[model samples]
Target: MEILADQTPLPDAIDERLRSQLTFVIEVDRLKTVLRQSPLAAAPRRENDAEHSWHLAMMVVLLAEHSDEPIDVGHTIRLVLVHDLVEIYAGDTPLYSASTDQQEREEAAADRLFGLLPPDQAVAMRALWDEFEARVTPEARFAKAMDRLQPLLLNWMARGGTWKSPGVTADVVRARKAVIGEASSALWEAGQVLIDEGERRGWSRSGS
Candidate 1:
C-alpha cells in the first residue's frame, strides 16, 4: 500500500480523511517488525512490539481488579495499545540499554507516526501516548504497570530472559520493576517473589 504524504492527492474514489486513516493503518503495521528484548514463552524469537502491546492489553482486561485504584479497563487497554505504536518509527529501546536520548527519540517518532492521521486523530493518538508516559491517571498507571509486568513474566519464564544479559542484576530488576508497585501492590509483591526465586535459582545475576 502506498503511504501518501499529507500533501499528496488522494484518488477521486476515496475521501481524504479515509485515505489518511488507511495510510496510518498501513504504517503502523511496521510495529510487527520492531522486535523487543524480552523473549516469548512459546517461541524461540523475541516478542515484537505488536505482540507486547496486545499482551498488555489482555493483561489489563484480565488483571484490572488488582490495580491499586479503580481504573477504566477500556481506557487502560487503549493506553497500552497506543503506548508502543511509536516504536514503529523509534524502534524498541530495551529497558537495560540505558540510552540517554530515549525520550527524545520516542517523542519524534510519536510526532511522525501520529501525524500520518488526520488532524483530530493525530491529536487524540498523541494524547493517549502522552498519558501512558505520564502515568498520572489510574488507567495510565495500571497500563504502565502491565507494561512492566509483561516483560518481567517473560524474562522469568525465559530463565532470566533479559535478566541474563550483561549489566543486568537482581538489583537492577528490582529498580526497574518497582514501577509495577505504583499501580498494584499485589502485582508488585508477586513480581518481587519471582525475582527472589530467580536469584536463588541462578537465573538472575546478583549484586547491585
Candidate 2:
C-alpha cells in the first residue's frame, strides 16, 4: 500500500499579501502554547489561549439571544476570537494572579503580532481587539460577557476549578460577574446561581 503525503508547498505565484496573511495565520498557532489558569471542563490539563478563544466564539453563537441589547453576532464572534491573540506573545495572566504591568505588556504584544498581517487586515483585526477591550459597543459588551462566562462555566463544571485558588474570593467572582450583568441580566442571574452553589460547596471563599 502506498502512503499518501499530506504536506504541500505554497504556490509559486502566491502574492506578498497572501504570504503576509499566511505568516500571521502560522504565527497565531503559538496561542496554543499559552495556557490559561482555567482547566478544561472534563480534562485535567489547562486549556490554552486558542481553545479558550474558540470556546468563547461558540458561546457567542449560542448565547447571543441572552444579550440585553441586540448585537451583530458575527462581529461579536470576531471580537472573542481576536481578543486573546495578543496572549500568543504576552502570555496568559491568571485571573487571580496580580500583574501590575499586564496591560502594558499585552498592548506591546498586540502591536507586534497584529502588525504581521497585511496592512488592511492588521488594522481590522487590531480594531476588533481594541473594541473588545473598550467594552462600549453592544457587540463588544456581549463578547466580553462570553469571555468571562466561559471560564466561569469551566470552574463550575470542574467543581470550582480555579475558584479554589488562594486569593480568589466570592466577592471577586461577583465583581467579575458584573460584566456579565452589564451585557445580559439573564446570564448574570445564571452566573449568580453558580456562585451561590460554589459558596455552598466551600469551593469559593465567602468574603472579599
What TM-scores do the predictions have? 0.95, 0.93
Off by over 4 Å in 2: 1-13
- For candidate 1, give the lDDT: 0.91
Give me the candidate number with maximum lDDT. Answer: 1
lDDT of 2 by residue, 1-208 (tens): 1111113434658797887787677778788889899989778899999999999999999999999999999999999999999988788888778789889999999899888789999999999999999999999999989988899999998888889898889889998678999999999999999998899898799998
CA error at residue 98 for candidate 1, angstroms: 1.6
Distance from true location, Cα of 65 in model 2, Å: 0.5
Model 1, 1-208: lDDT tens digits are 3443434655768987898898887778788989999999998999999999999999999999999899999999999999999888788889999799899999999988899889999999999999999988999989989999999999988988899989999999999999999999999999999999999999989999
Candidate 1, residue 177: Cα displacement in angstroms equals 0.3
Candidate 2's displacement at residue 59, Å, is 0.6
